[model samples]
Target: MRLDQMSGAKLEQDGSSWQAYAEQPLTFQFSFGDLQTNQDKIAVFVRSVENGQPEAWVQASDGEYQLTLAQPGHYTFEFKARDQAFNYSPVTAVDVTAIPVPAMISVPLLGEVEVRIFQLLVLFGSLAIFGFGYVSFEIVQHRRRIVAAVERGYNPYISGEPVRRVDMFFGRHDLLRRIVSTLHNNSIMIHGERRIGKTTLLYQLANALQEVEDEEFWFVSVYIDLEGTTEEEFFHLLMDEIAQTVRELPELAPEQIEILNGLLNLHLAENQYTDREFNRDLRQIIHILEEYGAVQHRGCQVRLILLMDEMDTLSRFNHLIQQQLRRIFMRDFAATLGAVVAGIEISKEWERVESPWFNLFNEIAMAPFSTDEAIQLLTEPVRGYYMFEPDALDFIVEHSDGRPYRLQQYALEAVNQMLHHKRRVITLADVLVAHELIQLSGQQPKGSWGEDAARGELGVPQTPAPAT
Candidate 1:
């Protein structure tokens, strides 16, 4: 007898007594031969030992048999072949050892509960690995993009300082036009809260005065910052600024500048310079300017406009000192000398009916930017370098309450957020991030957003935006 075509079993040795190792279920084919009888007359009988079942000789007419070893044990099968005359051949036996599958296999000997726990652990572990890999990839890509945006240098907002560049200034068109049209004959007073662009407007007015093309009047604008001036040094500082400004005029010759300097030095000396002396020296300076304008500008009159900033300090002086200033503007020099004073508020002393400054000049109140102005301010500064989504622009405008300073602060932080995320188009989510950062640092705006507080600290540089 020969065993062949075995599956799920590996034969250890080849002989009449065969030993094999297998994992159930195992199957094999057998064949028997007799010299005196035909192949069909042959019969094979099999019995098992120590297989956890009843042992008996079972006649197997077929040439194939199968064994299912449900338990781990040593199993033996004895086989005998019988010829047609009932003659029996020598017995052949095969031994097999059934063993447990590897623990790494899909199914193990663990109970049903343990099997479910193992399956759940595998599923959760796979999810965690996938999640970790996905997050790592996103972080790497974000870092690469930030590096690229930084290399491009795309910041275009200003904060924490006054705007100095003319192109960077926005809005105030009607106010500027009105101020210029009446600046020749009328003195103007500009009053507004702090950080409302008062200083910037004064600088703009000076620049605008230089560009005005007047046929009859030569406009010479002199800027005087009265931030720390006292009543004692008032006349001295005024003469000094006048002399410095007049010396820079291109039309004045060297000898003419020397004469103007000499006149200014007379009142700027250590002596107690009174308003009368100031008036005298200013009269002489105006005569010099008028003569120069006559000869060089075809007889145009000389109009000297003083753009004084930080005038709030003047309120600390006594009413008499304020009267002296009003007297100087109310004299004959009123025709040739004009004043544009800017401050946070007009002194209460000036509101009195009989006060010297009660009706001295035309007052223009400063206001926050309008919606259209805010849009222009946000977009024009970064027209080509970056862009703002419509909702982002609306978010800034609505939260900032159309205040130029707050608008700049919001824009500064929002652009920083965009740079951090390496984005060119600013979105509402970026604005929300900026708001959260500002709130965390206790720099959020007041009035519209919350209680009254001092202005926020926004430390962005004041560089001019790139030209469109």
Candidate 2:
């Protein structure tokens, strides 16, 4: 006998329900009749898409189930359901309307949490992009400005950049006066190490004597460097200077010009005519200068200041060559020309010539700037355009060994750090940073504190963030 079966289903909101149908395939077939309500509907039937053995028979049976309408769509449930006699139900179909309910989101906390997390990520991501762009722009602009300024040769430390003056002056009063008096009768040797500003000091001495109006001294200063110079080139350059000086002097008549000129060329030229010929030329140039002074006829003192920088270069030659050059200065040129020979402590070869008249030359040593001088060098003339804090000036001077090169290097680097780091008021910490960068780059910055001392000396204050 055929088992006649019926199945029903329902859905609840306020515990209300809707009834649905179950099917029996062994009996009559059911059709999807027209419904009246405007709601979504679904029909579920079980059928194995593949035909096989008993596994296919189980898959073809419609299983026992409940109606679970989640959304407004059609769904099909395919499974097996066995009856009491262990006979599986045949594939069946049922259709019902599911009244659409407003979706009440179940996870209120989780939904809100996801939205908040998304908002935070977007906010932080935007901030990161903006911050990176701003920093990059600043770096580019700063580099551009630095390149432009360097091209213009604008030094930030000192204001009023002057043209490269051949005659740069320094300050020394009584010492210059005594040097001038000595140079009038003697050729002095200026002794100093490199970068001690001896060349500048000599220029100042020359300027001082030149500025003396009431003194009847006609000062003619000639500066030369013997470094990389041959004896021929050395004397040749000196002759050019002396000839130009004689040509420009108003005290000497034009009629005397050729006599002096001829005399100079004769002595200044290659004297293959032997040592006697070379000495004759040297003595002729010296005699002409003395004659020019004597011809002034009004008791005029024609003083010639011959300033030789890097006199140590003469040592590169044989001792005899250096001795020959010294003979001219010690004997003949000593009477008419005031000579300032500048070199380091090792430049003794210039004075080692066997001439007792070397006693007439005074040896002046150039030392590094004093503390007060270094301070003045750092602060003055740069007061308005730039400034240093009270302790900042002292800190730089103390650490710079009173060396001008290092003083400027430290100050310029400190300024760079302050600008680069966007710090308004420069501190000792900035100095330390600049120092370390210079050291790491293999630059031995003067007065540089070691790492341990720097860490101990410049203790920066840490700022705490505000409590949220």
Candidate 3:
């Protein structure tokens, strides 16, 4: 089959591009000629000039196709003709480019027209939803298809689920990198309320450490959920988990694993198996780990990171436990043994008992997602399957305010709303509807200003985080 006409043909493979309006839909028409009349169908591929990811593509017999590429970036297109005999012929191979030309395309700010307009609207104090289209059935069906496609393609946004899998987790790249770097040399206190993604951040720390490169010390992470855990339980769990973590670490000799296990079991076999014995041997184990890294395989040294999550449980532990932790982190083997403590108020817990060991950690204040990171958290989970209109995405970011749980939950609801309206793309109006529904369901955040803030609220103050 041969092509009839290509839209935006000024787009050239030589890096030249056609300046198409952002959000403009490009259409191409194809027809079967006498020579290719026996063709079963023709396949079309569209790719972004920036990342080479497709904007849209489909196999069709002979017809017109359209896709609204709202992202303002360089894009390329290709067309292929496949015959009934399965023979393929090229119509265009990376031939055309579409570049979006918007008034504020050069703005350092993110999102698109919606964000720009919303900023302006905020200044004018008129953020009310002036007009919105009625939800259409086609939009709902389209949105459902996208939601289902997302579930099949990548990890779907599950409410209350910590992003254990790396792919499901989005954004926080810079934060994760920073935490990992800090963990290499020092321990950190992750300060944030529960459900703000502290657990996932800790998991991501483990995930990043799992791919440790040679020469860098391999941090054997022992994740300890300290919520409701007593001091005795902590001792038992820490020893049990060290055995488990050894197995998960990289480049451990059979002797190395046995040595670690034997060390832990030997301490447990103490006549009393008391906290005193647990503390002493745990330090010995930390020293052994440090030595292993310095001597064994020319890979990561035996550094270990204790992911002490829900650190609030320390409130229930006695000063002995605190003293033990202090000596362990500060005196025993600070160089090789790192810890990441996650909790609502790390300082508050430390204040319950004055401990200089708390001073050893560089505090990492876990704040809400930033705008750009929020965009990735919103889009990456559903990449390639569906898209959020600039305004819709901005609206969600504004309402959710970088709290990952709210963002995912609201985005999921918006998808449901889109599916209910048979829409493939989420719009500002859709976000508003979802916002209202969430508010009605009693899930809206407390302390939010009423309708004025709800409609066109601008710059609601976020909770101030303590300085690190």
Best by lDDT: 1
Ten-residue stretch with the least lDDT total in model 3? 459-468
Q: How accurate is candidate 1 locally (lDDT)?
A: 0.75
RMSD of each: 26.5, 28.4, 23.9
Q: Considering every candidate listed, which one attains the maximal TM-score?
A: 1
How well is each residue in 1-468 modelled by candidate 2, as lDDT tens digits?
111232433332233222222221222223221133211222323432312211222322122333344444333333433443444435443323344443333344455344556667669999999999999998887665444433332223421121123222222344567777766566677777566566656656656666654355666676665667775565565566666656676777665676665654445454333344445554665555667767653466666677777777755656566566667666655555677877785336434545333454677766667887776666643333345677787777877676665666666667666655554445677777767766676653432222222222222211110000
lDDT of 3: 0.64
Which run of 10 residues does model 2 get worst, by summed lDDT?
459-468
Model 1 TM-score, all chains together: 0.62
TM-score of 2: 0.51
lDDT of 1 by residue, 1-468 (tens): 776566665444445344454454667678889878998888888888875664988987578888776666777777888988889988877777666543342545554344556778889999999999999997886655444434444455655566667888887778888999998789999988777888888888888988888877879999999998888888778888987888787778777777786774564553577677787788878877877887777767888999988888887777787888887888767788899998887745466797668988798889988999888988887664568999999998998777777787777778777766767788888888777766777763321212112212222222544211
Clashing pairs in 1: none
Clashes of 1: 0
Q: For model 2, what is the alpha-carbon lDDT of residue 181?
A: 71
Collision pairs in model 2:
7-22, 9-20, 10-18, 399-447
Q: Is candidate 1 or candidate 3 better by lDDT?
A: 1
Model 1, position 342, has a per-residue lDDT of: 88
Per-prediction TM-score: 0.62, 0.51, 0.57
In order of listing, the candidates' clash counts read: 0, 4, 13
The reply for model 3, stretches above 4 Å from the true place, is 1-155, 214-216, 250-257, 260-272, 279-296, 351-353, 444-468
